[model samples]
Target chain A: MEPKVKSAMQMKIQVRKKKTIVAKDRLFSFLFILPSILAIAIFVYGFIGWTGYVSLSNWNSQIPDFSFAGLKNYVSLFHDFRFQADLRNTAVFMILFIVLVLGMGLMIAVFLDQKIKFENLFRNIFFFPMALSFIVTGVVWQWILNPSTGVNLLMKKVGIEPMWYTSVKVIPGVEWGKIQVGIPIAVIAVVIAAVWQMTGFSVAMYLAGLRAIPDEVREAARMDGATEFQIFRKIIFPLLLPITISVIIIMAHISLKIFDLIYAMTGPGANFVTDVPGVYMFETTFRGNYYASGAAIAIIMLLSVAIFIVPYLLSNRKGES
Target chain B: MKKKWFAFLSFMLALSLLLVGCNSDRASKSGGNGTRLDIFSWWTGAGEEDGLKALIKLFKEKHPEVKVENAAVAGGAGTNAKAVLASRMQGNDPPATFQVHGGAELNDGWVAAGKMKPLNELYKEEGWNDKFPKELIDLVSKDGNIYSVPVNIHRGNVLWYNKRIFKDNGLKAPKTFAEFFKVADQLKAKGITPLALGDKEPWTATQLFEDVLLGTLGPDDYKKLWTKEVSFDDPKVKEAVKTFKKMLGYINKDHSSRNWQDASQLVGKGEAAMNIMGDWAKGYFVNDLKLKVNKDFGWVTTPGTQHSFMVITDTFGLPKGIKNEDDVMKFLSLLGSVEGQDTFNPLKGSIPARIDADPSKYDAYGRLTMKEFKKARITPSLAHGSAAPEGVVTKVNNAVNIFVTQQNEAQFIDALKTAASELK
Candidate 1:
């Protein structure tokens, strides 16, 4: 009976030591993560909070006058003709850019899948532009689209001289205040440059998506009397829905915050045709010294990107569940 | 084995490159007894940057112990520099000295924000009070305290014409708006663009309008417009807008796609007959395009504005919170010196702000402008940030851009009035 009592006492001590070791391990893990959390909290969230504060204040010039101005800046921006035009141009640029990139990316992916010669070389060529920054793209495209000197000069030899960025024409019948609520014709030139740089990303994504589908699925469709086109439509396209949505979300964020390309390529074109909120914000804050107005533009841009992403995320979570 | 060798070679090469980059960065950060003077400006183009470098070389000769940083940030005609300057100033990390236009851009913008130090002592110690013109000194001063020193003066009302085109077509330079229209009609009939306008940046259009306003209101009344003595709704202002609209019709068809440099090229190529730009175009023609001065091109004042000299002056001021005050003051003194002005302005395609600068060292065009400067009435340029405040200029820039495409005269006038009221 004394021996049995000693064995129980030994087991109790072992259990106590395991509990202490686990608590010590938990403390060490917490210590490891503390620095990262502190850094993120101070750097990222701290700056964002400061920017939000600046937006609410009357800080315009060299001095920081943090007097609370409420939503006055937002009210004024909504009434601004330039901001209205910026909204219309951004919408048209985003929609057209996505459509072109997706269509061209899918087409290129399908062509490469045919076992074309030098497929690796073609893939590299297609993906090369993605490696360049938007600033470089804007500068190169600026030279190419120069109305009198660039591609138009060559197009003149072909008896087809199209004004690439010089045209200030817009679609008719929609108007908001003094701003035209239609697609600016000149934005197409900018769209082409943006799409050229970004299509590589979509190509890689879509190609990977295409490769993920099993060869047996296509074989099963063909054996059931489905044609090649029928097999692709019924079997492949639907499978790419998730990837398409991801590409859309990624591109929407880029198009919303675009500044360097538009600033470099076509500055607030004739009557502000090519203006985006990013360019407008830059001018208002830095050049115009309207810091609050510029911050309003920043907040609006963030909200716009959120509007696109939040619904998509909710539905994605629902689908996963 | 070959793949491993290639990878090792690349790793070593990258490592060497990074080491070299870091070495140079450290070198640039230190020198001259640990004293670094940061001089900021927007002079990054070929001729302008060269002129700045020449001035720096002259400074090194005088003070070899002081290391200077040429912080030139270039974009959109100093818009990017101004933004960077604003951020730096607010962050309490102001440069030793920064470029600012004389007049309202300096006093009403920076000094009002309490970022600039009053330079009345510098002016007195250097005897610059007697060197620069009273009008210019007043522009750089606030309430009798001078704040900056002027370096170069670019005449904003200069009209450049292709000499061969005028001589071959049997045409003479016009002096009045009516004569200008007649000359434009003749040139237009001959399939030549009458005016080489590049409004892609919009301020070029505003520059032309400012010249028109000068002609319509005269210099005194024009000054009144800024001080709010005369309103933009005045009938005389309406006349100026009408004249500006008429002038716009004679511009190049592809003006919207071109910047000022591209428009200047039109005159150089003889594709267009005339361009109204600052005398900097003279440098482009003589230096860059290799055209002979007075032989390939000629200049006169813009039509009906010959009596008034529209001046765009580049000046540098000492911002508050400078670490190296003695070095900065020495630099400013050199910038105001006759030797420094002579070294800089001739190469920069501008006349020296100092009246004592030697005319023999300047080009033929520069000599002529110097002679005219001694006698002409000095009127400040509005578009170049001399006559108007920043807020007003921003509004005017936007309004001019809209009017260029919409051609709405009444709307343009109303916008100008709003700009005036907002400035008040």
Candidate 2:
């Protein structure tokens, strides 16, 4: 063979090998992710599909009866008093929990943003509750908020009698169809406990956001003769909106599926006031063996969760675009 | 080459995690063929736990070849334990035996699910049919097949009172509705809570309500109500609701915050006059809280129901798919035996389910209870699951919880009528 021809053959082989390397890299990444996608499809999506099917059936008895009853479980849920109470509780809890957590978190982050002494110590102290499980926080708060023995003891000294978590629905209940809708007084105590534990997460996020805001922007505003309040109101708060949305989405999801905390602290407080979907779903499934109703509840929770999370994902996609 | 190595590493890691998940499941299934006995119960409290340990020790001595695992879950009134059992059963890993309340809790919860192995053959062989009371036997049976062996019985309608408080106020144990109200009125005027009720669990209120039902409607009518021979909306049932509502008005203000034990404490401390709780409160009082029985506190059947015994029996059933059926049967036989019942019940602070339990082994309350169990017309309890199904109990609990706060008599009656449909 001619030397030029042999050299051309070797160069062609090397170029082909480089091209194959890129293809091989892409192939390997796909292979790695394929198992996860398949797993999620089978396990998560499969269970979800199964639950939806169950919800449309009359599987209330111990036996898993999957004969289609259609729209019945959902229709029953809409009229169901316990489910209505659960919805009312969840709405109130979500609003109260998010607002308080955000407010406390922002306040703490702003304080920490300042050149304060023992900043790390104070940060850790606030974040400490987040480190503990919701169950742990719930139990500790349960003892502390006990109407007779806990904070009420302190209140007793000041000639005040407070019911704490034991207090029934404070909001004068109005008939919402067959169900009575009201702000459960007991849920307020739960909100305070939930907020205390979760505020640290928001604090960390808000702190990062506050720190990420350039000092030059604030300085420029100051130089333009803007008051501190005006600078915060106009610049800092608006800049933190993205982070605020993230916090709201994350916290709302956590609040929706709240079971362990409520179960441990107070097992369905007076008239199911502290009752939420997670607890109701658990009890209906395990306690009553109402598989269909429980599935209906799970689907409702998933849909409600999507109401918050779907928009966030779409917004993230838009930001990237 | 390094990229290939990374790919291989990640692949192996994923495979290992998948293997790890599969392995634990296999480990549980593998034990099914082994000579292992796993006894599950929620008896993890002071006296209850000690009683369970003693029962295990006796079983150990009798069947030393069997490897025993005490799968007792510690929690309030077995609610958490039921959640654990549900998950375990769902995984198809049933224990050798697990504690169940005799009636609808076992039958409606597990038997209805086809999770329980019928124990009629065991009963025939062990002669438990003649050993246990027929009414009690009826509770453990569905369609003539005995499902479980009753270990001990806790009377739900027993009203415990502070002896000092009653004596201090010159009050006798109220035996009728009129007498109860008269005494309650006097106690109220003295600023003493007439009834110390801790309904934190809500079923505790249902317990009080069931007693009120028994008092309002006699034993036959009460039994008829559960069987659905009579409706829940019976005028007598209405009267029971009225009585229960009246009883609720006389209870402690902070009743919802405390459990049954805490209410017993209120009575023990002489702050409240009386508490209508199960006989287990006697265990909590004497064994845990360390108060003398019959001296610090005394008990009578919850008023107007002295002729009827409100029986709440703790039973153990053979769940399906357990390893060593023969070995498990030995445990069930022993559970029914006088020796097992006597050893377990004395420490448990409840009267043994077996009629032959030695009277000498029990306290004064147990002796009195044993006598009453034999003489009084036997009726099953609803809240603790001898009379009603879990579906019924769950609905009743939800309704009772709302009723405790709402105090709407019509709503409470309406709820009971709904729960009655669960039996059908």
Candidate 3:
């Protein structure tokens, strides 16, 4: 009985030792991440909160006047002609950019998937633009599409020269409130530049998706007496839906927050034709010193990007669960 | 247990080290005994860069112990520098002395925001009271406190024309709007482009509009527009708008794709007959394009207002929280001195702000402009952020941009009227 009691006491001490070891491991792990948590909490979330507060205040000028102004900055921004134009431009640019990038990316990826000659070379050529920054792309494309000197010079020889970005002509010419509610012709130039720079990313994604698909699926579709186009439409294209969604989400965020490309290329092109909320936010905030109004614009931009990302994130989380 | 404690302690040390590393950069830079003086400006272009280098070289010669750091940001007309300065000012890490446009930019931007120290004492001590023009002094002052010392004055109401084009066409430089249109028509008939313009940034068009306002409203009434004494709805303003619209009709077809320099290049290449720009275009012409002032290009006041000088002065001032106060004051005094202004302006292709600057040090164009600076009524430029705050200037630029595309006079005028509210 004494030996049995001693054995029980030894077992209890071992269990306590195991518990202390587990607790100590957990405490060390938490301590390891504590600095990152604090930094992110203070730097990112704290600054975002401060910006949100500034957007609601009367700190329009250089001086930080924290007096409450309610939604005055937001209200004015909505009514602002430039802001309205920025909205129209952003919507049109986002749609056109996404559609073009997806179509071209899929086509290029499918072409590369074939046992074509120089497949690696073609893939590299399509993907090379991704390596260049938007600023560099904007600058190079600016020269290429300069109304008089660039592509126009060549097009003029063909007896037809489109004005390119210099044209302030809005399509459909539907006047809605302060801005013309249509796709600005100048924005098309920016879209072309953006698409050229970004299509490679989508191509790489779609190619990865294509490569991940088993050879059996395509062979099975062919065995079912399907044409090559039909096999692609029925099997391969459907398989790329996940990739398509990802590309859309990624491109949407980029287009919504695009500042450098448009800023470098056209700079709110004649009458804010190529103006995006990002560019307006920058000019208003930094150049004009309208901090509150700039903050309001920034919030609007965040909400815009969120409109695409939030649902995507939620759906992703749901899928994971 | 020892390993866990060791890991935790190491993690804490690493984080603290990271914090220290981030702070040490700023600490090391600012730890000196006020030896470094950062002179910030957007003077990285051809002639302007040379001017800044010469100014820095001159300062180093005068004060060998004081190190002058030329923090020149390269962008057209301080577009990049202004934003950098704004951020630094907000962070309370201002450079010793920085460049700013004199009037509404310095006064309304920094001084009104309580970021600048009043330079009344500096001006009085340096006897700059009688050196710069009274109207010029009024621009850099608010509430009777002078805030900056103007170094170089750029005339904003200058019309630059290709001398060869004018000579080939047997045309005289136009002196009025009616004459300008006649010349424009003659140039158009001769298959040459008239009034080269690059409104890619929009401020170029706004500057042209401001020149039109000066021509129509006269300098006094033009100044009153900023003060709210003369409403934008005045018939004279409408006339100015109409004249501006007419002038716009003669611009290059690809004007929207180009910048001010590109437009100036059109004139230099003789592809276009004329360009209305600031005298800095002279710098681009002489320094960049290697064009002679009188032989290659000729300048006249924009159509009208020949007696009114639209001044866009690049001034330097002391920010409130800078460490090198004495060094900054010495730099400001140098910028205000006759010798410093003469040395800088001749290279910069701008007239010295000090009326007493030596004329012999200037080129023919500079000499002519300096003479005009003494006699002409000095008016601040709207596009360059002298006549109004930057917000108002941006609004006006937007309005001008819309008008450029839409050509709707009523809408443009209404936009101007709305923007006028911000003038207060």
Candidate 4:
């Protein structure tokens, strides 16, 4: 009976020691996170808060006086023809960019997985563009896409005599005539550049997803006399759903905040053709309309990303569950 | 475990103290230096760099104790520099001295906020009114107070042409719009593009529009149109637009995407006939590219204009919260002085702000511009000068760009009307 009581007392002492160790672990974890928290609070949160405040006031160039005109900036933004145009351009770019990047990415990944020659070389070739800065890629793309100086001249040398880059013609009877347009050309150039840069990233992710599938699953399908195409369509594609959704969400976020490529390729003048919400925000702030309207636009862009991402992430979580 | 926690806390406290010390040191260095002045500008390239260095050298020689640090933001039209400057100023960390054109755009926000110090006292002390050109003095002053120092007078109405091309065609410099068209026709007949135009930059198009307005419509009408006194639909304004559109026929087919320097090179290489750009193009010709002034190229104002020269000037403004007030005063005094203006302007490919400078020291074109200055043929360019406000200028630029590229006269008129109405 005394031995039994001593054993219980020993167990109680052990339990108390474990609790102290757990508390110590928790304290270390908190300490580890403190610096990151401070950094985010000071740099990220502070800038965001400052931008929000600036967006409430009309701060023009060289002038520092900003008056709180409350919602007047928003009213003006609604009426701003350029801002509306930019929204339309950004929407079109986002939709088209996502479709192209994902579609191309999956196809390339699948082709590489088929035991092609120079597999590593091909993968590296596709991924090399991703490593370049957007500014450098933009400049290269601009040189390639410039109608007068680039592809047009190359085509001329090849005896193709390309006329499409210079002039725009619509069906005469369709309430439109031949009107010269560069905006569409500019947008296409931006998309091509973006896809070139991002397809490698998508390919890498898709490859990982493909590799995660167990060999037994494929062998079992083969044993069932399922064709390769049938196996890929029915089994492999379905498993990639999560990865595909994640890629779409991430690419969408990237497309929304795309500024450097567009800015470098074409200056503010591109606002006529390829202005996105990001570029518009820049112009607005630079033009000294730095108050409610700028903030409103930023908020609008944030809400848009949230609207798309929240549902996607929720579904992803549910899929995991 | 307690000792570990105590050590971690102490380390964190030390780190925080270290950060605080570093930040305070930075703040003091940037904001508390009495002899140091930070000047931000968008000047780069060998020629411009040389010119700026010369000016800085002179400034330092005059004020031995002061140290001038140049924050050069190199981009054409200063769009990048403007963005950086806006962000910095918004963060309440403006540079000591910054470049701003002498116009409403330069004075827009800072002047309204009372963030710009009036240079009126400096102007009086330096006797700037007696030395500087009256037109330039008027250009830099707002509400009877000088806020910026006019550095160099840029003639924006100069029409530069390859002298060889003109001579080969047996055509003299056109003195009237009618004569200019005839010359254009002659060049076209000879299978040459009459105008070597670069319209990729909208400002280039705007410059063309301003030149046409000043040359065809005269200064009063141009000012009235720019200031929104007259609607764009007015028959005279429409006439000006029509004339400009007609001139567009003389440009190359690929003029839509060429750079201004490349366009100038077209003339330099004798590929195209002429280029109507600002006098700064002279720098590209005579200074950098080694084309002789009045020999390889010729510079003239657009024909039959009441005002022979449309002048714009580069100016600088001191931001509020300037660290060294005495240094700011010294800088302002130096900027307005005859010696400073003369030394800086010639290197900048612009005429001096002070009319009292010796013309013998200037280039042929500069001397000619100085002569125009003497004859009172100087008028402010609406494109670069102080005719319209900033928002209005941007709107007009967009409208003109659309007009040129879209070739939609009605849309152009509507856009202009909208822009004009916004001014009020």
State the DockQ of every prediction. 0.36, 0.55, 0.72, 0.32
Assess candidate 4 and give its TM-score to the true structure.
Answer: 0.90
Model 1 residue A176 CA deviation in Å: 3.0
TM-score, candidate 1, is 0.92
Clashing residue pairs found in predicted model 1: none
Model 1 segments more than 4 A misplaced = A1-36, A313-321, B1-33
Off by over 4 Å in 3: A1-22, B1-4, B29-32
| Tens-digit lDDT string for candidate 3 (B1-424) | 5886787778779988998998885686676684578889998877788989998999899988897788888876787888898888988889888999989998888998899899889888888899889999999999999999999999999999999999989999999988999999999999999999999999999999999999999999999999999999999999999999988889999998899999999999999999999988888898789999899999899988899999999999889977779888888898899889888988888889989888999889888888999999999999999999998888888899889988899999999998889886
Reference-based TM-score, model 2: 0.94
Candidate 1 CAPRI assessment class: acceptable
Candidate 3 chain A, poorest ten consecutive residues by summed lDDT:
A24-33
Is model 4 an incorrect, acceptable, medium or high docking prediction? acceptable
| Model 1: per-residue Cα lDDT over A1-321, one tens digit each | 999999999989999989988886786567557556776897878976787888888976555788999988888888777788899999999999999988999999888788789999999999999999999999899899987878888998999878747877888727768787778999999999999999999999999999899999999998899999998898899998889899999999899989989988888988889999999888788777878878888988988998999999999899899
Query: What would the DockQ be for model 3?
Result: 0.72
lDDT of 1: 0.87
Q: Which stretches of candidate 4 lie over 4 Å from their true place?
A: A41-80, A158-183, A268-271, A288-292, A317-321, B1-3, B14-22, B30-33, B225-233, B421-424
User: Each candidate's interface RMSD, rounded to one decimal?
Assistant: 3.5, 1.9, 1.3, 3.8
Among these predicted structures, which one has the highest TM-score?
3
* TM-scores of chain B alone in all candidate structures, in the order given: 0.91, 0.95, 0.96, 0.92
Tens digits of per-residue lDDT for model 2 on B57-134? 999999888888899987777877887887788788787789988887877778888999888898888777788888
Better of 1 and 3 by lDDT: 3
Error of 1 at B153 (Å): 0.7
Give me the runs in candidate 2 sitting further than 4 Å from their true place.
Answer: A1-15, A179-182, B1-17, B20-33
Error of 2 at A309 (Å): 0.5
lDDT of 4 by residue, A16-35 (tens): 99999899889888887887
